[model samples]
Target: MAFGRRRFLAVLSTTAAVLGLASPSAERAAAATVCPLALSVSAQVSPPGGSPYTVCSGVVPSFDGTPLDVDVSLPQDSSGPLPLMVMLNGWGHDKTDFESTTPAGNGANTYHWNNAWFTGKGFAVLNFTSRGFHRSCGKDPATGYTYATDPACAGRADWTHLADRRWEVHDTQFLAGLLVDAGVAAPDKVVTTGDSYGGGQSWLLALSQDKVMTPDGTSVPWTSPKGVPLHLAAAVPQYAWTDLAQALIDNGRGSDGLSGAPGDGPHEDPVGVAKESYLDGLYALGTEYGQYAADDPTADIPGWHARITAGEPYGKDPLINQIVRQLADYRSPYDMPVPPASVRIPVLSIQGTTDPLFPAVHTAQMVNRLQAAAPGYPVWTFYGDLGHSYADNPHQVWAAANDEANDWLDAVLAGSQPTTARTTLSTTACMPGQTNATLTADRFSRLANGSWTFTGSTGAVTTSSIPDGTEAAAVDPIANSGCRTTPAQSDRGVASWVFDPPSPGIITGSPVVHVTATPQGADAELAARLFDIDPASGTQTLITRSVYRVTGSPGNVQPLAFELWPAGWQLQSGHRLRLELTQSDAPTWRPDNETSSLTLSPPVLTVPVRTS
Candidate 1:
């Protein structure tokens, strides 16, 4: 399946009968004029029956003149034109992530993306490898090097654009055009969705304008050959980041400036530093796996290498580092100060309650912004298990979250209005088959609060190795039954508090934690955790957690405001709520260098309690 310039030219030449050909004979009559596409009927079968679909795999020219590998799935059983679905893969992954093929090459699910399910629901799914990833034509073919390693690819690597309006966003419009021209997808009626990297791209696609200036200072056409604008009928971004910089750094400001703060601020001019472990992974994806480092014979190549270096500790320069962070925020969905009224498409955002990577509060922030832009907009949010894993768990309901999303998409396709309900699927509060459960927030001012302070010696220090793998220790929040014996209360450099409710209470939203800590070192890191403790046995079950970091004066008591992972949990009558403040969690965040006696003020944990 090697497609070069000649192959792309062949596809372009065979485009005549693709649009409005009407009949098979007409298609054949014009076949000589239309370049034939390299398409095949995949063995993949649809669910609920054995319906089949055709897969067109090849390279399509993207907005930046780079060719991207694309997989177009069309149901052979379709009676007429179908709505288009463009799926974006997560970071460092290609179109293969959505495929059902296992590592051993056995096809377990038949279709990687459950394409058969969507095709059965009458959708044409376009799965394409984003530029600069997995066989995409961004690297230098002669040396097989990527932008990560080879300076030659600097001008064309798709990741260099990093979901920029001119690159990936523009490429989506171009791909949709190709589908439309081929008569496989309907124009002006496409739904875009994906998880993580792909999920974030969906928001960029919806918010982007129809004009773009390429990185090389050239203006490109953002429309199809027929001049049709890219029309996104709806979008469903799962676990996506609304603001990339904020998601990375523990900055006090929330997505909409109305959300929440990193520190309980009253202090002036504070900055949120980068999370090293996660940033390291993100940067490595471009250099190590993205491009062949071995192929580049140079020592300490620039670009990503230099950026990674700059990202290390207090960063390059205080002013410059802050500027870079601000730039990232401006480039993301946060740029949309007001949701465009033109984008009336229903948005169904799916988030993970226990995901440390991209916290659940981001979903609420997005929902608030979208609804604020258009009052009564059909925007919905569903909270499920942690991260991208689909493993079964007792704490979260992945099955129900998926079902609700499908139902919303089906309704939108049928011309129904978007659902206004915001739901969270939790086995504790709203069990499966239960009805009439509403979500509410338990305010901080409403809860009885107490303070616990643990002071470390002036020389006491904690550190962990870079690129920590401890995050995978507990994939599911409830997967680790042994957490009861973990003993978080008395750990070194940790402060603990306990809450015992007389009656059982259900938490339905993001939990806020306020900490006023006296800093001892040049920089500081604070992590907050909520634990469900058994009053009698003293066993602790971790509920959720959040991390915050800041750089400033060491003597002042810094007021930090942050939220734990948005979660829905039922605190049984005898169960006690424990709040623990820890100095560091290796692999999760970079350790603070300075050793200081930290004093914690009365820490308050405010959870959203469902009422009625």
Candidate 2:
């Protein structure tokens, strides 16, 4: 991530020749008509034997006059306005995630999509550091690096709003508008694509359409500093969340009464369970690599993490619930008003079936809502086993998904129909030496054409009073890079059911579970896991799971119904589908700290299967 100075005069001379300008002065005069802000050329990057591209690195003032670090890469041969691709990074990462050749945070390799690659594809790539990360008005407390120079942030740190529409999303729109005004990018051919945190921003940008939300909470036409109108042509959001609350702190009570299924309206109250490990990991990364406005009372990042980490009595604190809900709802695209069809654009959402953080369900919910609101809007989704967790075929899945996304973008820019299917699902390679397979359907639900149900009452299963050690240890989304084994049943807190399919098939959707539970304390939680038990080796591979929080009188019987995280895996004839109902799945999920238990009746498990 070196930004060595390049010969600016010589580069400008060369750019003039490429642009057919008579001299450097002519090129400067031509650019002066469109570009009002000063730009500095930091470095020139060329992919091995490829045409060199200029990387102009500088700062752009956002809506509130906050300086945002930005890098604009332009190909030498491109003439007139070029199609733009705004490359974004994940949580706790900066623009370097798309610049450097080396791997950065979260195993993100630049070879996948870099400045040179996009420039080679005839696109002008814009990569910028999000606010409170690296150089964009950020101060890493751990390293004593400061970029907070705004007058409002003079006495304190300028914290990240976690991609709030009014801040991070607006910053992107404003930057894109600048590029459009500078005559560097086409006004109608701009696309936003990113992973994880940036993925969330990508979703927001697409939803915002031709308008941007102002600091005063009003919507205005997206325009540049020079008054040039702009809009997003397409968006490719990978491993993103439609609803922040449902993704991070889920209550498992969806509006449709089907637990994890896409609800009919905005997410309701009763703040959900905390995903302790993921939340803590992100907060730590922010503090270590980025910056946090820890002392700012208006900042919610510090306060939200602290309150959730305090543990237990979750629903009892009314103020804490308000903080959590307000923070999540404002940042979630699911809660936003549906955009009109006139401004809506094409979207190709890519998600990981194995991603524990933002699973396929998030994208599914978004696609469902979008289609419901604006029918035939050219929205497509590709679900594969490539994300935060272990992927059976990482390289293969990654390549295919990215290739599909690029093809979709190409088609959009060309004003043609894409050849890729509307909905594509990739199954994990369960058997030794077997390659992952993909299936196509018109809709997400069609991928799972059939189901297998196990119903009947057995005996009540009680949970352990302790939270940590007594809980079953399953897949660590961060640590387990390779396929790992999980226990089918634990001694104290886990209730298990084994179902043997009559024939071989593929399970391709979320599994719904129903049970009647009586809480030993005022509040209780249940973690459900679905595993594929190999009949020959007697090994269990964790497929998908989710956690549900139960709140009621101590002895009241609550009929708990929820869907496990969606997954796609091939099941053998002799292999068994084991459903484990446990009180806690530690590290991955924060268990209730109270010394309480949940007594459950025999559960009914319904798993979706694909015959063809």
Candidate 3:
């Protein structure tokens, strides 16, 4: 069943039909190659169930000589050379994790595990275990260092440092060399796509320059066997964090509910305040799978652990905290040091608006920084109401995100898309259980703005086993219950504002919320929720929510800014838009320390109402 150029082109037509691409025109049909460059492949043939693909597995030496386990799947019926796609796994996961359904039941993924979907479209996929995970090899030299021992050495080679350019990025560069030297992939036609950590790695590979700096301050040339600069065509990073510190701590909000305020918190216990249960799980995964060394039990996981235990006044009191912060700054992809303009790669960034692990703000911030550096880089985005994994949210949302990703890959590889230009965002939105009601936008306009004042509570609620955080109305709105009795607002430390629109419209894009308030105490924690209220029944359906921490002089009024998670929700005539303000939401946020009254002024919710 070997496919020549003609056969490969024919197969593409079938794939196009399935993917809803343009009808295969005569020009495309006569085309012999799917990729702009020819592929060079070396693999072992495996034919299962009468279908065939070339598979190969082996250990490749990383830049620092660490052994990396890599698996490659090549098209069995290729007419000529092929394009290469490298897929990386998330934290603590080996390459095989992508081959099956995620434990969280995100989307039943075919792209990660089965090569057929990609191979059928004429791509060679290379999946590799990151160094220090699974069968890969790397030693955390810091594992043996302690505060009583060598403090500087203890911070080196920590788990969080796993993604440092000197390590993971080097490993990727080394693997690219192997593929090119083996003549299985074109040096310039390679693209990387990964989820979470894997997604971050893809960005690292695509954005990194031809030179990498080692820990000892040594510069090494990152080049192919032929000594050419390592050139990666494009990247797609889904649910990936650009700033590790922001991802783990700081939370873009300071201690005492203020953003950019000094110190982690009054006590400096970031783990407890910033989602303890969730972060602890991540720590456990990294420790169990980090495998710093098979022989050593005392290798420090990473500098964060040491800093976390040290607590507040993070950078000053404990010198180690300062060291770890420097380490994080070194590895950070966004922020100071590395100019955003330097990491310009055409990117299709996919993020979950409802994700608890790596909140939607992370992607929004990353995009803003990237745009700031390179004003018009070709960056496209798809923000779905998804959680950490696709399955963490609703199935319908995953379908939309997954399908759009496929279309992006096809268009980019075909040269129909540009990599450096203003980001052209996709307009696709999804809602679960809606068969007839579509998620589309007509026109966008700002509904007139107003604000309200509410009391901020110092009282904290007990945590629930169910882990219900900020429930977004776009994803968790009451069903046909809108047809039943009206839902009442929670009387517990909450404020509400109701709006009646002149006409029916869809809420599209990110909605901006502005609040002017003075905290009765030193600081206050706030959560905002948007609801679509049924006029007849007064039933309220939650559409989206956002949380913020405000800090300032106890009695001084300051303006606070935050956005409700982006939504593409439908609104009908006579429906009321209600904005709910609350002081505390257990599990999602730590309740404020004091019973602070918030002297709030009129808050404005400017929704992007689709008018057409």
Compute each candidate's TM-score over C-alphas.
Answer: 0.74, 0.88, 0.68
Top-lDDT structure, candidate number: 2
Best candidate, TM-score: 2
**What is candidate 1's lDDT per residue for 424-497, written digit by digit as tens?**
44433222222223342222112222222223223323322222333323323223321323443545445666
Candidates' C-alpha lDDT: 0.53, 0.71, 0.51
Q: Is candidate 1 or candidate 3 better by TM-score?
A: 1
Per-residue C-alpha lDDT of model 3 across residues 1-612, encoded as one tens digit per residue? 000000111222233234443224422432432321132222222222223344455666555555566767666546433677777777766665443211122243332224444555577777777766655643223344122232322323423345666667666777776667666677677777777777766656655654555655465666666675556767877777666555554333321111221222211223222343345556666665554432221224454554453333332445545544543544555543422554355677766544545545556556655555666655666665543522133455555555666776677777776332222222223222222233321111122122222232333222111223343222322121111122745443456677776776666545556668777654555666777777566467566665555666776878865566555556776776777676655434444444566766667666665556
Per-residue lDDT for 524-544 in model 2, tens only? Answer: 768888888876776787878
All candidates in order of lDDT, best leading: 2, 1, 3
- List clashing residue pairs in candidate 2: none
Candidate 2 overall lDDT versus native: 0.71
Return the TM-score for candidate 1, rounded to 2 decimals: 0.74
lDDT, residue 108, model 2: 31
Give the Å error, residue 462, model 2: 2.0
The lDDT of model 1 is 0.53
2 or 3, greater by TM-score? 2
Return whichever of 2 and 3 wins on lDDT.
2
